[model samples]
Target: MTTTSPHPSRTTSPPHLEVTWTDPVTGRKGYVVIDRLVRGVASGGLRMREGCTLDEVRGLAAGMTRKEALHYDPGNRYIPLGGAKGGIDCSPHDPAADAVLGRFLEAVGALLKHHWTTGEDLGLRQDTLDRVLAGLGVESSVEAVYPLLEDPAGARRRLADAFAVDVDGIPLPDLVGGLGVAESALTALDRLGIPRTSARAVVQGFGSMGGATARYLARAGVRVVALVDALGVVANPDGLDVEELLRTRDALGGIDRSRLRPGDTEADGDTWLDVECEVLVPAAVSYCVHPRDQARITARVIAEAANMPVLPEAEAALHARGVLVLPDFVANSATNAWWWWTLFGDIGADATEAERKVRDAMRRLTSDMLVRAENLGITPREAALVVVDRRLAAIEERFGGPGAHAAARREGSRP
Candidate 1:
C-alpha cells in the first residue's frame, strides 16, 4: 500500500474515506473511495481499465452514493447505505489481471467483510470475482442458487452440474443494464407525450450497454437511425439494422466498415450530438458532451446510460433548452439490478420474469420521479437529489452521523 496523493483537478468535497494502494506483486494500482455509509454498509462495483485514476474512482463513488440514496431508498424505508467505488488502473486485457484482482480483494478484505460489498463494473467480470472469493474462502452474499421456480428441478440440476458457475440467477451482462435505459427513455418520451413509434434514436457507443439499448429501442418501434462507436459513426434515416450492426461491432464497440453499405454514411463518432433524433442515449465514455457539443445537441431527450456522460455545464444547458434529461443513475440499471438482487433476493424464476421485474421497476420509478418533479417545477436531477438528501437527513437526525462502527480507515490515512 502507498500513500494517497492529491489531484488538483478534483473539485468535489472530501468523501468519508479515500484510499489508494498498489499491489506488491503485480504492481497494479487501485483506489477505493467510500463516499458515505449508512448503518455501516457501503457498496459499488470494481471497474478495471488502463489509465483509470483515483479521482475517477472518487467521482464514481460519489455518484454511487447519490444513486443509492435516490434510486435504492428514496422513501427512507431502509437504512441509507453509503456509496463506494473501487478501481484498478490496469487494462481488462492484461494477462496478470487475475493476480492483481486477487491482491486487491485481499488488500480490501477488511472493508469487504465489514462495511463494503462489491460486484462487477466496466472491465471486471463476475466470474473472476467469484473465483477470487472462492480462493479467499469468502462467502458471497449474492451467489446464484438453483431450482428456479420456472425450471424443472431435474433439468436445472443437470445444467448446474455441467456448468462450473450457476447460471440460474445470473443476469445477462448487457440486457439487464440496457433494459433499464430503454425503459427510462420510453418513460421520458411518454412524459413528453411523444409516442415511441414516432421517436428516432441515436445511440452513442455500440458495446454491451449501448448495443443492447439500441436493439431494445428498435424492438419497441423506435427508429434507431444512428449507431456510434469508437471507430466511426453510421447513420441512416430509414433506421439501421441493429442486429446487423451488433454482429459487426468489435468487443470494444468499434464498428467494422467492411460490413456497412452505400446507404449508410460514416462520420466522426462525436458527431452523434449533431444527429437529428428525438432521443439520444450516451452509453459511451464519460464527459463525451462538453459545452460545444451541448450547444449543437439536436435530440429532444437525452437518456444517460454511462456514469457522468454529460458534463455539468452541458447538462445544465440541455435542461435550459427544455430537453428532458434522465441522469445516468436513474437511466442505467447496471448497478441497480445487482444492488436490488442483493437486497431483495431473486427478481423471479425465469429470464422473462427477471426482465419484466426490472422493466416494471425502472418505468415506475422513472415515471413517479419525473412526474413529481414536473409538478414541483424542478429539474429531474434536482428532484432526485432532494429526495435522497431528505431521506439521508432524516436518518442522520434519528441515528446520528456514522451510526456505530465508525468507518474503517487506515490509521494514518490522509483525507
Candidate 2:
C-alpha cells in the first residue's frame, strides 16, 4: 500500500480518534476514524482501494455521523449510533487483500471490542469480512454495541435472519442502500414534475448499490440507458438489459463483455459522463466528479450511491448549473438505518416490510431536504446539513453529547 499523506484540509470538528496501522507482513496501511460516538459505539464500514487515504476515511466517517443523526426519530426503537470508518490503502482485487484485512482487524481488535462497529464498504463485502472476523474470534462486526442491546442474543439472531433474506435473488442488505438511492431519485423526479417513464439514467457503477438502483429504477418505468463499470461503458440509447448485465457482473463490479446483448454498445470508460441521461449516479468512488467533469454532466439529478463521490467545488458548480444532487448521506442512508431497524426490532427481516420502511423513510427525508433547499434558496447538501445539525443538537440535548456517555461508561467500569 502507498504511504501517501492525507490531504491537508481537515474537518472543522476533529474526530474523536484516528488510528493508522501498517501490516508487518504486507506493509499495507489501514486507517480507522471514529468521528463521534453516540451512547458507547460508532458505526461505519471498512473499504479497501489502492489509493485510500486517511483524509478520505475522515470525510466518510463524518458523513456517517450525519447519516446516523439524520435518521433520528423519537418514536422509533432504533437510536442512531455515532459515525466511524475504516479503510485500507490497497486494492481489494490484490491477492493479499484478505490477509491484509485480517491483520488490520487484529491490529484494531481493541477498538472493535469496545467502541467501533463496522461492516462492508466500497471494495469489501460482508461475507468476506464476516469470515475474517470469525477467524479473529469476533462474534460480529458490530459486537462493540452488544452492551447497549436490551437483548443481545435476540438482536444478533434478528440481524442474522435479516442478512439471510433475499429479495429478487439479491440479499436484502445489498439492496436497501440502492433502494434508498432509487427512491431518492424518483422522489426528486416527481417533485420536478417529470414522469418516471420519460427519465433516462446512466449509472457509473455496477456493484451492489448501482446494480440495485438501476434495477429498481428500470422496474419503476425509468430507462437505464447505460452502466459504467471498471472496464468501460456498456450503453444502449433505447435502454440496455439491466438484469442481464447485473447477473454477469463480477464482485468487483467489472461486467462480462461476453454476456452483452445485441443492442448494447461498449465505449471507453472515460465517456461515461458523455452519455445523455436525466439521472446520473456516481456509485463507484470518491472525488470522481470534479469541476472539469461537471460541464459534461447532462443529468438534471445526480443521486449519490457512493460516499463523497462528488467534490465540494464540483457540487457547487452543479448547483449553479441547476443540477440537484441528492447528497450521499441522505441518499444512501437506508442500508445503515435498515440494519439497526431490523436488529432493534423496529421492523422484521421480511423483504416487503423492509422495502416499505426504507422507501417511506427515504421519501420523507428526501422530500424534507428538497423542500428546505427550495425555501432557503440553498443547495440540497446545505439543506441536509441544516437538518443534520438540528437533529444532532436535539439528540445531544436529550442523551447528552458523545463524550458524556463515554465518560459515564469509563467511570462505571473503574473499581
Candidate 3:
C-alpha cells in the first residue's frame, strides 16, 4: 500500500517525514515524522507509546515549522528545512521494545548524512540511549555530546536547555519552553481580563517542560496549585511547594508515590484535566486527555506545553464548549527561539541579550496570535495555524515552484 498521506491540507506541509521499523520480537510496526529541517541538517526526539500514530507525528512535524520560523532570519525564510520524526507503539515492558528501537536507529541513521539527528523519547530512557549509542559506536556520553556541539546561544542547545537540562549553567535561565508557555498563558489570561496578581494555575507534568513552566509562572506571580510527576499526582489548593517536589523527582521524572500523597480530591488518571483553575497546562506524555475527560475540564484556558499533548478531536470538543486553547506550538516556542538565534543571529552578545531576544519573540508571537484570534473570529489554536500556514505558504514557493503554494492553499482551506 502506498503510505504517502493524501496530499496534506496545504501544498507544503513538507513531505511527511518518514522512518518506520517492525520489531522482530514483538511483531509491532512504528514510524517517525520529522518535519522542517532548516539548515543542511536537523534533529528531534522520538516518542514511543500506544496511540503514537503517524497523524500525531504529522501534527508535531507541522509545529516544527512554527518553531523554526520563530527565529526568522533574513535567509531562514528562504531556506527549506527537512523536518523528520519517528513514532512507535509499544509499552516499555514489551519484549520487542529494544529491538524495535535499535532497528529504527540503524534504518533512520541513513539520513545522518543529510543532517538528520534523532534522540530517545517516551518509553525510552537514558540507559536505552546508552545501549543504542554503544551499538552505533557513538563513543560519547550525554555529558560529552553537549560539549562537542554546545553553545550558550545556539538554537539547538538553548532548546535543549528549555527542556531543562542546562549545560554547565552557562545558559543561565535558558529555556524557551517556560518563557513561551508563561507568555502564552499570560496572554490567554489577559484576554479574559485576568490580572497577573490573581492568576492561579496547575501543571500536569513535572518533567522538564512542566517544571520550567511552573517555576516561570510562580515567578510571574501566578500561584501554582499542583505539580505532578509520573510517580503519582499531588495537589494542594493552598499551593504545592515546587522546591520540595523537585528534590524528589528522579532523572527519568518519576516521583516516588510511596513518600507522597495527592491532595486534589484524589481521582485516577485524567483527573488533572478536570482540576478547577484559570489555566490547565499538560506538559507530559500525549493523549493524557481523551474523550471521557473532555467535558470534565474546568479550566478557562488550556495551554499546551508538550508536543501534541491534546488530540485533535479532543481539542475540537473543548473548542465547542468554549474553552480557550493556547496551542502547544505557540506556548512552547522558546526551544525554537533559542535555536534560531544561535543558528541565524549575532550570538556573541551577553546572556541578557539572548534572553531578551527570546522573550521579545515570545511576546510578539503570542500577542499576535491572541489579537489575530480576536480579530479573525477564530479560536486561538486556529489562529496559530493561520500564522503558521501563511509562513508555510511563503516557504513552499521556494521549492520546485509556484504550483506547491496553490496546492497548499487549497489544502489549508479544507474544512
Best-performing candidate as measured by TM-score: 2
TM-score of 3: 0.76
- What is the clash count for each candidate, in the order shown? 0, 0, 22
RMSD over all Cα atoms, model 3: 6.9
Worst 10-residue lDDT window for candidate 3 reads: 140-149
Q: Which residues of candidate 3, in runs, are more than 4 Å off?
A: 1-17, 25-28, 34-43, 75-80, 92-100, 124-131, 138-175, 256-267, 343-354, 397-415
Q: Residues 272-354, candidate 1: write the lDDT tens digits.
A: 88888999999877767887788788788899887778877787788889988888767884445534442333433345655
Q: Least lDDT summed over 10 consecutive residues: which range in candidate 2?
A: 1-10
Query: Of the candidates numbered 2 and 3, which has the greater TM-score value?
Result: 2
List lDDT for all candidates, in order: 0.71, 0.88, 0.61
Q: State the lDDT of candidate 3 residue by residue for 1-415, as single tens digits.
A: 1223311224354543566566666666677665654423344556677667776666565566565544444443113244455677777666667777777666655564344545555566545766876798763222211212324235345444443434333133334466678777877787888886777788987765677677677777887876666645676676666655555766655555554545643345446665677888998876677766788888778888877677667778888887888776678867545543443334423455556766676778878888888888777776776766776556544433433433332332111
Better of 1 and 2 by lDDT: 2
Give the winner by TM-score: 1 or 3: 1
Cα lDDT of model 2 by residue, 1-415, tens digit: 2212122112237788999999999888999999888877899999999988898898888888889999999888788888899999999889999999999999999999999999999999999999999999998999887776778799899999999998767788988999999999999999888899999999999899999999999999999999999888999999988887777788777888999878889999999999999999999888889889999999999999988888878888999999999999999999999999998889988999999999999999999999999999989988888888888888778677655786534443121
Candidate 3 lDDT: 0.61
Ranking by lDDT: 2, 1, 3
